[model samples]
Target: MAHTIDISVVPPPLKSDWNPPAPSGNSVSPLVERRLLPAGPAYLAHVKRAVHKLTFEEHDKHVEAENERLGLNGTGANGEDDLGVGDEEEPEDLLTLDAKEWKKQDHYAVLGLSHLRYKATDDQIKIAHRKKVLKHHPDKKAGIAGDSNDDGFFKCIQKAMEVLTNPERRRQFDSVDPHYEDLESEVPTEKQIKNTKDPQFFFKNFAPVFEREARFSRKQPVPMLGAYDASKQEVEGFYDFWYNFDSWRSFEYLDKEINEGSDNRDDKRYTEKKNKSERARRKKEDTARLRGIVDLALAADPRIKRIKQEEKEAREAKKKGKTGAANGLSAKQKEEEEKKKAKEEAKRKEEEDTIARAEAKKAKAAAANAAKKARRAARATEDGTPA
Candidate 1:
């Protein structure tokens, strides 16, 4: 075992940038420099051959380790746990979603942010998108069963990213979010609220709904639906605020797509007209819905009746005091009574003005209805029909 080894036959140690030499028989070189290796399939294949290969499991573990090292494996920017072990399996329908029909897709669900929905911040969305890409990229899924050229879910992720990254587009999507629609559908009806025996039911149920709706308000610090014991002013202010709510919500997201590849100007115009009409209809319905909520809240408010009763009692007490202390009051007391009377008179005048305005509105409506009926009658007579 002590025989001398032949040192002359050993090749010189390769430099740091050394590359393998081309085969002697072949005229063309297959040994591409590492810098130039990514340019073509042939060069890439050569590079792969020179590298040590890992099994699929080992590759996945390597990727996971890299992700962890990069701080991409823990909680997201919004402080929610990253989509991992405990997340629900995606639905078959979601997996099969057509990217072409992106308008119909739930972008938040596609990005695994359904629980957060519109509340999910931009950073959170980005993190979720990246996680999805890493897990479901086509290259990563190579050799996996049922994987195909049609990367429907991946395409959905890209579409979702495209929409949610743009502020205007995200707002449009949020406006008509189906999650909100579901929440609205679940809101207790006016009849149900009115019939509930529990005194706290209104506050308990409607508080959450109003809070949810408040997010759409253009104005900040939205007034809340207060508890049963809330002050008269507090209750009145809440109703007033909601009744005149200026919402940023719009129906542009639900606009119907123009027929694909149809370049006819008339067709485009017609589609635009329909979309505008639909937007108006939806806006009107939404306004009515909000008005109904306010109306119901006003009708159900216990504070209004209590305040009215207190006002009546105070009025009666003042009357009794005035009658009983006809000539026995001090100068200060007289002055106080005079001020109180003046204040009451001003309040009365304001109430009368409000009533007058209401009466005028009714009269105007009646006149309009009478004019409409007259027009219909005249038209009927002209057509030789019954007036």
Candidate 2:
């Protein structure tokens, strides 16, 4: 037996235009009439004047039919199969495209042009856009090229016009254009570094590594390298920046075990210990790897030696010019010079003393740790437990 519950409907006190209108013989309803477009063979023509979205069946049927016509086995269309199988070009043209890679295709390809993207004048691009608009526009699609192609490709052409026509968007697109070949890889690889020529090429090509690392931090951006003619301070700063590079890499994802649900305290502690050791090891490896790269760059650099020699030559020239001159060092100047030399000597001695103390301290700590370990081992032996 079926149980039924009484449901009551309440009418509003006042009927406004917000309420649905009474049923009508008219095919288009009055209430949502503004939300729709004029009746067309395809529904999307008047709404957004863009691509017609197809249901799974409709899309599949279209693809299957196209495959049959092109004598393809439905893997996907290839350029050999048809002139419109543009998918292969997209990946080859963009290796590091951010998102929706298929959607952000080559604007030139979208407009069905070649070799004129960066060189094409705005008027020429506009003219080409208009011609394409006239050719494949949905308004003219029916009866002209009916069912031969969807509105998607034409919409891409329209989008290409918008992107290629605007100066700023065009600049951004061009920056990531795979054809630029400014740096062959998104991040410099070992091969790229080995193949790189001089400091200029090294600085520019290695920038992508810093850029990749930059996404790890909010406070820092990748440091721009100084030119070979940079001032002493700027050169020092560039070196210091790389020397103190803080990588944001972590090995948390590589944990052998995770302390998730159903783990006891011992299990949790074991997992934590494993993760800690792994993180420390990874950090050490990263620091050493970075230091090695920086060292390689420094050794390969041709500027540092020149800068030092230039400074030395300037000092020697000044000394020779000043010797026995009317403005030669006074007695007071001589005293000040002696004091400065003495102060520098004292500072050097102090730094040496500090280094010696640090080394001694480290040695002492190691000795203490060794003694402690030995004692622990002895105790473990006495207790008959694993050391």
Q: Which regions of candidate 2 are displaced past 4 Å? A: 1-201, 257-265, 324-387
Off by over 4 Å in 1: 1-89, 147-150, 327-387
Worst 10 residues of 2 by lDDT: 81-90
Q: Per-prediction TM-score, please?
A: 0.61, 0.34
Candidate with best TM-score: 1
lDDT tens digits, residues 17-57, model 1?
A: 98888779957868866654257855564555457475556
Where does candidate 1 have its weakest 10-residue lDDT segment?
Answer: 79-88
In candidate 1, position 40 carries an lDDT of: 85
- Distance from true location, Cα of 90 in model 2, Å: 10
How does candidate 2 fare on TM-score? 0.34
